[model samples]
Target: MLINIMGFLVSYVFCLIITPLISKLALKLNAVDIPDHRKVHVKPMPRLGGLGVYLAFIIGLIVIGFPIMSNIQVILGATLIVILGILDDIYILKPYQKLIIQFVAALVVVYGHVSVDFLYLPFIGTVDLSVSIIPITVLWIIGITNSINLIDGLDGLASGISFIIVFVFVILAIINQQDTILMLSFVLLGSILGFLYHNFFPARIFLGDSGSLFLGFMVSVISLMGLYKTVTVSSLFLPVIILGLPLMDTFLAIFRRLKKHQSVMAPDKEHLHHQLIKFGLSHRKAVLLMYMLSATFGIVAIIFSKAILWGTLLFSLLVIFISHYFYNYNFNKIIHFLNRKYNKT
Candidate 1:
C-alpha cells in the first residue's frame, strides 16, 4: 500500500516537473501540431508530451523498486511504442509504417508469456485458445493502440478517458488482489492526472502520437495482465466495456469509412467528439460528456465483474439495443443504403 502510494505520488510530481521541459524540447525540435481543415485547434502546439509521462512512469517504477526483469518484455515493447510515437510525431510516419512497428512490439511481448491461452466461461469451464493466442493478443494490442490514437482530437480528451479507464483497472486490481496491476495502475493514474493538468482545455501541449499510443499500449497490456486471467463469460466483456468509448469510436470510424468506400486510414471530421461539437456543445462540454460516458462504461464493467448469468444476459440485451438505436440514428444514411442493397439482393 505504501509503495503504491509512493509510486503514484512520485510519478505525478515528476510528470508535473518534466512536462514543461518536454514542451520546450518539442518547440526546439519543431515537433508541433499545425492546425488544418480537419483539426480543431487554432494554433500550432508543441507535442511529444508523452515523453514526460513515459519518463515519470519509469522514475516511479524505479522508486518502487519494481522487478524490471519480471516484466522486461512489456517494458521493452512500451519503449519501442514510445520511440515509434516520437518518430511519428516528428516525421509523420505513414499509417502502414506505424502499423508495422506496432505489430513487432506486440509480438515481442507475446513471446514473453503475455499471450492469452485460455478463457474461463460460465457453465462451460475453461476453453483452451493456445493455437489462437498469438493472433488474438496481437490484434488486441494493435486495436487498442490505434483506438486511443484515433480519439486524441480534443484537448485533455484522450488523457482524461485513459485516466478513467486506468482508475477502474485499479479498482479491479484491488478487488482481485492483483498487486502488480494495482501498483501499475496507481502510477499510471498519477502520471496521466499530472499531465492532464497541463493538457486540459486550451492545452499548452498535445499528446501527439507519442502520448496517445503509449497510453493505449499500456492500458491494453494492463488489461491483459489483470482482466484476461479472470475472465468469466460475464466478465469477458469487461475490457471492451471499460474501453467502450474509444473502441466504439474506432469501430464506427472503420464502419463509416468502409460503407463510404473510403480508406480506413483516411482522416475525417466525424469522430464522436466532432459529432458532439457539431451538436452545439462547447469543446469542454463535449469532452466532459464523453468522460461521463466512459465512466458509465466503467461502472457497467464493475457490475459485470460481479454479475451472474442473468446479469450477463441483461448486458447483452442492453448492448444490442444500444447498437441498434445508435446505428439507426447516428449513421442513418449508411444503414438505409445497406438495407436497400439487401432488399435488392
Candidate 2:
C-alpha cells in the first residue's frame, strides 16, 4: 500500500514538473495544434503533452523498481505508439499510415501474452478463441487506442475519462488481488491527474495524438490483464462498463460515419462533446457532465464485479439509455424524457 502511494505521488509530482517542459519542447518541435472548423480551440496549442505522461509513468516504474524486463513487450509497444503519435502531431500522418502503425503496436502488445485466450458464454462453457485470439486482441487494442484519441476533442476530457477508468481498475485490482494492474493503474492515475492541471478548460496544452493514443493503449492492455476473468457474462462486461464513455462515443462515430457514406476515420465536429456544447452547455459543464457519466459507468462496473447480476444490468441499461438520450437529444429535454418514461412505466 505504501509502495503504491509512493508510485502515485512520484508519478504525479514528476508529471506536474515535466509537463511544462514538454510544452516548450512541443513548441520547439513545431508540434502544435492549429485551430480549424472542426476544433474548438482558437489558437495553436502544444500537442505533445503525452510525452509528460509517458515519461512520468516510466519514472514511476523505475523509482519503484518494477521489473521492466517482465513487461518488455508492453513498454516496446507503448514506445512505438508514442513515437507514432509524435510523428502524427508534428507531420500529420495520413489516416492509413496511422492505422498501420497502430496495428503494429497492437500486435506487439498482443504478443506479450496479453491477448484474450477464451470466452465463457452463457450456455457454452469456456470456449477457446484459439487462432482468433490474436486478431481479437489486436482489434481491441486498436479500437480502444483510437477511442481515447477520438474523445480528446475537449480540454482534459480524455485525461479525465482515463483517470476514472484507472481509478475503477485500481479498486477492482484490490478486490481481485491483481497486483500488477493495481500498481500500473496507480501510476497512470497520478500521471493523468497531473496532466489535467494544464489540460482542463482554457487549456495550457492539448493531449494531441501522442498522449491520447498512449492512454488508450495502456487502458486496453491493462484491462485485458485483469478484467477478462469470464466467470459470468456480467463479469465479461466489466471492462466495457468502465470504458463505456469512450467506447460509446467511438461506436456512435463509426455508425454515423457509415450511415453517411463517409470514411470512418474522417474528422468531424459531431462528437458527444461537440453535441453537448452545441446544446448550450459551457465547456466546463459539458466536460463535467461527461465525467459524471463516465464515473457512473465505473460504478456500474464495480457493481458488476461484485456479481450483482440483475442490479448491474438494471443500472447498465439506465446508463445506456440516459447516455443515448443525451447524445441524441438536448440536455434540457432529458428531464422531460425521464419524466415521460417514468409516467409511462
Candidate 3:
C-alpha cells in the first residue's frame, strides 16, 4: 500500500515537473498541432506531451522497484509505440506506416509471453486458443491502441476517459488482489491526472499521437494482466465493457466509413463527440457527458465481475438496453432541455 501510494505520487510529481519542459521542447522542435477542418482547437498547440507521461510512468516503476526483467518486453513494445507516436506527431505518418509499427509492437509484447491462451465460457467451460492466441492478442492490442487515438477529439477527452478507466482497473485489481497490476494502475492514473491538468478545456498542450498511443497500449496491457487472468467468461467481457465507449466509437467509425465507400482510416468530424456538439452540447459538457458514460460502463463491469452467470446475462442486457435508449430516445433533447432549465433557474 505504501509503495503504491509512493508510485502514484512520484508519477504525479514527475509529470507536473516534466510537462512544461516537454511543452517548450515541442514548440522548439516545431511539433505542434495546427487547427484544421477536422480539429476543434482554434490555435496551434504544442504536442509531445506524451513524452512527459511516458517518462513519469517509467520513473514511477523504477521508484517502485518493479523488476526490470519481468517487464522488459512491455517496456520495449511501449518504446516502439512512443517512437511511432513521435514520428506521427512530427511528420504525420500514413495510416499504413502507423499500422505496421503497431503490429510490430504487438508482436513484441506477444513474444514476451503475454498471450491469452484460454477462455472460460459460461456454459461451454474452458476453451483453449492454442495457436490462435497470437492473432487474438495482436488484434486486441491494435484495436485498443487505435480506439483510444480515434477518441482524442476534445481537449482532455482521451486522457480523462483513460483516467476513469484506470481508476476502475485499480478498483478491480484491489478486488482481485493483483499487486503488480494495482501498482501499475495507480501510476497510470496519477500520470494521466497530472497531464489532464494542462490538457483540459482551453488546453495548454496536447498528448499528440504519442500520449494517446502509449496510453492505449498500457491500458490494454494492464487489462490483460488484471482482468483477463480470471477464468470466468465475465473476465473477457470486463475489458470490453470498461472500454465500451471508445470501442463503440471506433467500430461505428469503421462501419460509417465502409458504408460511405471510404478508407476506414480516413479522418472525419463525425465521431460521437462531434455528434454531441452538433446536438447542442458545449465542448466541456460533451466531454463530461462522455466521462459519465464511461463511468457507467465501468460500474457495469464491476457489477458483472461479482455476478453469477445468470446475473451477468441480466446485467448485460440491461446495459445494452439503457445505452441504446439513452442515445436513441433522450440524449440530445434531455441534455439540451436540462441545460436550458439550469441556465434559466
**What value does the lDDT take at residue 231 in candidate 1?**
58
lDDT of each: 0.90, 0.88, 0.90
Q: What's the lDDT for residue 277 in model 1?
A: 76
**lDDT score of model 2?**
0.88
Error of 2 at 76 (Å): 0.7
Per-residue alpha-carbon lDDT of candidate 3 for residues 213-316, written as tens digits (9 for 90 to 100):
99999888888777877888697688999999999999999999999999999999999999988878889988988999999889988888999999988887
TM-score per prediction, in order, is 0.93, 0.92, 0.97
Can you tell me which runs of candidate 3 are displaced by over 4 Å? Answer: 341-345
Candidate 3 overall lDDT versus native: 0.90
Error of 1 at 276 (Å): 0.4
lDDT of 2 by residue, 131-224 (tens): 7999999999999999999999998999999999999999989988888888898888889998999999989999999999999999999988
- Superposed Cα RMSD, model 3: 1.2
Q: TM-score of model 3 relative to the true fold?
A: 0.97
Q: 1-345, model 1: which lDDT tens digit per residue?
A: 899999999999999988999999999989999999999999999989999999999889989988878999999999999999999889999999999999999998898788777787767878899899999999999999999999999999999999999999999999999999998889988899889999999899999899999999999999988889885775567888899999999999999999999999999999999987776667887798789889989998888888787778887798789879876785645435544564578
**Count of clashes, each model:** 0, 0, 0
